[model samples]
Target chain A: MHELSVAQGIVSAALSHIKGTGKVREVHVAIGELTLINAEQLAFAFEIASHGTPLEGAILETRVIEARLRCIRCGREGKSFTCEECGSAMEVLAGEELLLEKLKLVEGDGDAQGI
Target chain B: MHKVSEIEVQEDLLAANRELAQQNRKLLDESGVTAIEVSGAIGSGKTTLIELAAKELKDYRIAAIAGDVVASLDAGRFEKLGIPTVPLNTGKECHLDAHLVSHAIEKLPLNKLDIIFIENVGNLICPADFELGAHARVVVVSVTEGDDTIAKHPAVFRKAQLAVINKVDIASYVNANPGRMEEDARKINPFLEVIQVSAKTGHNLQRWFNFIVKAVEDRKQHGI
Candidate 1:
């Protein structure tokens, strides 16, 4: 699915963000529900996509974010786009993000200090 | 130093895509072109729908960008219809990302065209995560695929502005219900417009053509 391509993006982003030489240990990502990404599927994809990269054994740690919906007319809050109170469509305020949050790296032999 | 440590990055991975998509939208707006991205599974009549549009929408100058994993089969079909066509192949990627669409748009005479129909790499799941800088996104689900196609792939429906249940002529033989698909699509997104048609027989496709016309008109008026 799209998870494999996204996992490759995570590995590449991690590689570019790190300073100097280091073996990546873990890559943390925040996945939102509205993005429709399955965390377990992403983990499996990360394992495969990172196989030949610097993040060969790096763990893909994902955090899920819930979607926040709000209705405009009545200012009511609900999950689905259709509002229960007003019956009008709700707007999405949060969730829809796929961000690379953090990275854990093991310093290489040539590395002098931890980043 | 073999020490292990964590560093904060907080980088947005999808930012590049969103930015490029925005750029593409701006370019299309400047050129007065309305792009319609059609996504569906293989054999879902995506090409046929576009072919019909090319033949019928004579008032508008139409071009096409066909995305496939390999081969230019779809592009060839568009070319045969006397339409300018660009074939894009994403070697291993499952979806047509904004980066790829922008690359294809560069090769086209954007200012000379009134509409561009982008046929996404045939599939439901992967395309949902990717937006190809289209004013309207339509998902085509055929009767041969099954009634549960829309229910199983809600993400695509949620992202699309409209949904098309195609191959209605053969629905009885296949035991597929287009009404169920239409219902499922509307449940996911209230604003989404669902239409059923048979591209093969040219049945009820005028409504879909009307949708394209209205979408272009709306985009022109809304100034997005």
Candidate 2:
């Protein structure tokens, strides 16, 4: 599955940002509806990719964003490509994003929390 | 007691691939090679369309990079057509990434080739996510795959610059409506150029060839 490669990307990104100082607690990723990525498959792939890495045992959390299209003629925004009011062709404004949003990490120090 | 912290880092998952794609695009431009990525599902007549195009455009120096899971059957087919073809065995990867294309380009005689066709691995979904530094992205969907094939895979249609509904000669035999397929493709991407051609009978193939020639001319003139 292509999700395996995507999962590996997330782990690589997370590790680069973490700087190997903390244990990864969770990875927050945003997947758009248009991306058609299966969350379960991505999570499973992340587990395999993060194996023996700093992200080992870390949780994978995905937030799905619904696809939104904006009509070019009427400037109407909706989910579908056709506008309800003007019935004109819509332009893709949002969605189709596969982003690594943030990382939740537990610091090695007992009390010092790094942000 | 462990201290938890949130690190704010916003990065696109495909950032790495996109960066490599940009580099590949620059390389193609510098080499003056108009690269087209031909993507479609397996048995969608991609190989036939390419073979016909290569044969018709015999005056131009053309090369091809055929991508497959394990076998180089498509590469061999192109080679037999007198086109210098490179076989890229992806080996379990569902799609061809920009990194693979970059390496393939180095193996080719870039200065001697005018047009390079990168026949992507036969899968509609994964290839849509990967950009192989092609000046034009062509998605081929045959009538035998059913009329709803375009509607079923809107993502690739939306990303593709041109949509070729191939095997139109057998549309009736296959019970597929080419008109509906064209309509669906346009609905998904209003700006997409939809062409219905039978790679077998060579129907409307001149138009396909003309499109590529015009695209190359435009790129050279406009430096796009």
Candidate 3:
């Protein structure tokens, strides 16, 4: 499944992120409309794929972006599926991406002795 | 007071699948086997075309990977023809991705094969999005399905290296136009190699076979 591959990427990214930092608690991802990733399946796949990695217990946070298209015939700028003036098929200019937008890591130990 | 901290990381979600697809491509190239993947809606005669290839490729070692969402009937059909087949059951997934192929290779002896025909699940929209380690993706359409299917699903035709118009023997019985279909396919992808065939009567099957053999030889000569 594509979800398995996506999960593998997330696991590898999380492991690399933690390696760069000291620890990782959560990872946030922004998936655009065209990626067609099922969030629930991706989460399940991530949990299973991360079982042997350093990100075993890490959490996955996701944000979905709506698909946006631009009118080719007219210079109209709006969020409608088709242009109101010409009603032609719009080109997908944006919002069809699967990006690892953010990662939240622990910088230092909270149980430090210093005030 | 509690402190809140966040670390930023940017990554690509399709990185793993793309990497694996590249590896599969390298494997296919090195093995000298032209991996051809065919896609179309159900009952489009993809298996029949594959059967034609298997029958004609007498000198070469041919293997196949038939993918279906539920059953392995297509793969079973290939196996009946004495060709080694690896059945891929995708469960609920619509298309066969690269990782599934990478795993299917374990069951197939790539070193002994010259051609690997991957008959993708019978669907147009979902299969277009995946790269299943194929050297060429061929799309099969039938006269019974109407000529406007290419226009309705332009992405599938655009992604395919070849477009096959099958079931021409029944064209007169169904009022189908081959000329318009070819035009629509070319409009979607001008470079698409279009072939008309009928698996029932074996018309133009030799041309399809010639196309496959020539494609394999061409790829071999170019070292692709």
Candidate 4:
């Protein structure tokens, strides 16, 4: 799936942020519902892409955010695709995000036990 | 003792691709090549539309990059038309990213080309997520695919600058309503320019050609 590319992107971003720091322990990413990325597939892809890199054995955590749409006709905001009051088309206001939110790094001793 | 620290970093997942896309945009602009990304489902007549456009826009030098999962069948068609064609086998990739396109540009005779059309892998969902630094994005939907195809794939339509409803000649036989397809596309993207054409019978193909010529002219004038 395209999640492989997405996972590679996440690994790249995380590695860039944690450059010169200690080994990465966990990576937290936020994907919007509109992106249509499967969380399980992303984790698998991340594991594969991170192999032999500093991110090896790092835990991948994903958080899916709900889509938000704004009604064009009624000026109402909600998660639904259509306006509940006016029954008109709604514009997507959010939920297209695919961001590397945060990273957990272990400093000092590089003990791989209980990772 | 090992200490775990949480660092808050908000970075886009597609940042790397987007950065390369910017570079591509600059390259296309500097080379004065009007690039357009054409995306659609399999057998939706994407190659046919490009073929027709190449014939109609004979005054301009045209080159095309065809992307497919396995075969370069579409690229062969372009070669037959005498247009310089580059076929990219994406292997496991669903769509062609900017990185691949950047490499494709290096192989082409950019100095002689006026326009470069990128026919994305036959799919709607994945191609919409990628930006290949094209001046415009066109999505083709044929009548044989059903009128609801536009409504079914809103994400692609939303990003596309133009929507081509092809195969109007077979609309009656296939029971596909072209009007509904245009209306659905408008619902998704109100500003999206739409045209109905039949690449087979050359019906309304002139309009499509005119659109391309105008886009190229506008890009040249605005330097976009």
Give all candidates' CA lDDT scores.
Answer: 0.87, 0.88, 0.79, 0.88
Instruction: Choose the strongest candidate by TM-score.
Output: 2
Taking the tens digit of each residue's C-alpha lDDT, what string does model 3 give over A35-115? 557788888888888786766666788888776767777866555444667765456665556778776655566332222
Candidate 3: which docking quality band?
acceptable
Compose the digit string of candidate 3's lDDT tens values, residues B16-104.
56678878889888888888999998899999899888988899899999999998999899999898899999887778888998988
- What C-alpha RMSD does candidate 2 show over the true interface residues after superposing them? 3.2
True contacts kept of 4: 0.64
TM-score of each: 0.91, 0.92, 0.72, 0.87
For model 2, how does the per-residue alpha-carbon lDDT over A29-112 read when each residue is reduced to its tens digit? 999887767899999999999999988888899998788888899888998765778767788777877889999888776334
Model 3 scores a C-alpha lDDT of: 0.79
Residue B3 of model 3 has an lDDT of 38
* Cα lDDT, model 4, residue B155: 85
lDDT, candidate 1, at B100 = 96
Cα lDDT, model 3, residue A107? 50
Cα displacement (Å) at residue B207, model 3: 2.4
lDDT for each residue of candidate 1 in A1-115, tens digit (9 for 90 to 100):
6788888888888888888677787889999777867899899999998898878877788998788989877889888867888677678777778999998888766334433
Clashes (N, CA, C under 3 Å) per candidate: 0, 0, 0, 0
Sorted into a CAPRI-style docking class, model 2 comes out as medium
Chain A, candidate 3, TM-score of 0.78
lDDT for model 4, on a 0 to 1 scale? 0.88
Write model 4 residue lDDT over B1-224, tens digit each, in one string: 77778889988766567789889989988999999899999999999899888988889999999999998999999999998999999999899999999999888998899999999999988887778898999999999998899999888887888999999999999999999999889877766899999998988888889889988998899884
